[model samples]
Target: MICIRLFQWGIFVALSFVGCKSEPQNQDQKSIEKGIERIDVTEHYVSDSYHKRHDGFDWVAVSVKHHGDESLWVSVRSRADQKKPTCTYDTKAFRIDKNTYESTYDGKRIRFEFFPTSLTISTENPDDSNMLYFFCNGGATLAGHYGKIDGELDTQQIDLTTFSKVLNLQGIGFNVSSIEKDNKNTLTIFTFGLENRDYNETFTIEGQVVIDAEVEDLNSDGSPELFVYTQSVGSGSYGNIFAFSVNAKKSMSQVYFPPTSENPKINSGYRGHDAFTIVENTLSQRFPIYKEGDTNASPTGGTRQVSYTLVEGEAMRQLKVLDITEY
Candidate 1:
């Protein structure tokens, strides 16, 4: 779609090296809403540095996709061997200009400048390039000019073993990464730029896989909330959410999400495959309803959409059902 949607929300293993297929932007899509500007770019680029090595080429590739209304999904990787990559980076870069985006990590700013047929990567301060060394090995740096690739980039070439996302608002940020090991996924979230470092936390999610995560100021409190969506591996694909709210930009607290099974009013015919997004200030969840005798592949019942509002509870914040509609 790379522009962050109405509310800004929110990686793979590279095993192979392939190019990206450029996709056309939809002209009818709105580029700005409520003064929120978005950069529209969905393309791939590659570097020729690989040709320098005869034993194993230093191949670097980049993929940029429209994320929401104001962000781009940017992924960069460098491979010296077909079995493993030397450098890998995956995160959301927020739009700074019509064709430029930037993301801050490890106290450094990495910028992406886009052109008609090329992309240039650089650091805000040239000396800050050293911070990027954390993701690379063997003296490989992600900062360089890459040429646009005309073909589709085989995403499978990048390692999908780990998923990562970076979200920021009001000077608070989070780096969320999930790594799967032995059928269990360990979700690690590192908070940065927080007024109180003690608020940062890491979690271990067993048996389920993280599908996606999002950040938003759901209560208009000026601080953001983190929403992590996950699904169990198997035929069911049952979805679950892990969320936290920033407390006055100092500490963080978990936001309770009522299970569908406990909420009898909305649980009828519920059977996984659910998707979620924030609409205005509410959390919106939509899923296909399954009637009796309905196979997992098909659901005769119409779709059910539910919206939840963030409210203060005695102990913690909770997402309370605001409304539900089916059609």
Candidate 2:
């Protein structure tokens, strides 16, 4: 199940919910809103060829746990090419996040010359709009960290088709929000896609690109690691897992297949989540976490269990799974 946190103005409802049950809720709410600052958000994405291959939906991504208030943040650009990702950050009309700081844009290009009307704004835009957008929302939710861009901004007509990018998924229509390089060559990716989102065999994540992916020397190895997420494109739910490699020299051989157990169903094919990293810098936790069923139970359900780990050189990887279900 996905999680949701509501926000009134700039303050989180939870902060008020439990904090002010018997107290004056509206007063606390007004005080928080009156803090008088600004609020901005940024959402990034990452995916692979398989995510964009079949389903049009490449991957899915969402902002860090926020109050989902009237304010909104729209992703503008995250092209597949790592060398040239143009996220609209500096524009006054756009809201952005920093990789290391809460106040600054994460050093990306944000073209918001097409300010106000450039975005359909709430009324929720398109279900597939991946670009990050900012909403001042009449400036009522602006927090301290929130600040305006550097220069003039306006609405300039550009091809809407070029605004598209592909992504990947986990648990089907799922997408990860954060993928921090762990202490090891492994990755810790947090899924912040949608709420109550589930993966049925019929859903897929496609046409999304992961941008600004990097790793830190959490272990002080001098070399930064690369972390990535997996999003399915065709015929199934997207954003299934996260994956990694020690380096170019130690890449593992992998495979994908339909279930063929003695009591397998007829047309049921299992979707795979990416390799998970249970620990760090140990080259450990390497395996597949999946749910499967035979063709006979295709639409109704499938069989799923703890599969085997990826047999690495001289070592065996372990699998860590929280839950498994099929549709």
Q: Indicate which candidate wins on TM-score.
A: 1
1-327 per-residue lDDT for model 2 (tens digits): 110111112211100000000112245544544354443323222222112423432211112223224323333322222222222121112233221122123333322111110111111223312223331111111111111222221112111111122222221111223211221122123222333432221112244322222222222333222233333333442333333322222222112221222213322343432222223332121222243442322433333433323223433222223234332
- The RMSD of every model to the true structure, in order and in angstroms, is 9.1, 17.9
How many clashes does each candidate structure show, in the order listed?
Answer: 29, 70
Local distance difference test, candidate 2: 0.24
lDDT of each: 0.68, 0.24
Write the residue-wise lDDT of candidate 1 on 78-160 in tens digits: 54236556656676678888777887775678887766656667788888866655555556566665667776644434445
Kindly provide the TM-score of model 2 when superposed on the true structure, using C-alpha atoms. Answer: 0.26
Residue 326's C-alpha lDDT in candidate 2? 37
TM-score against truth, every candidate: 0.62, 0.26
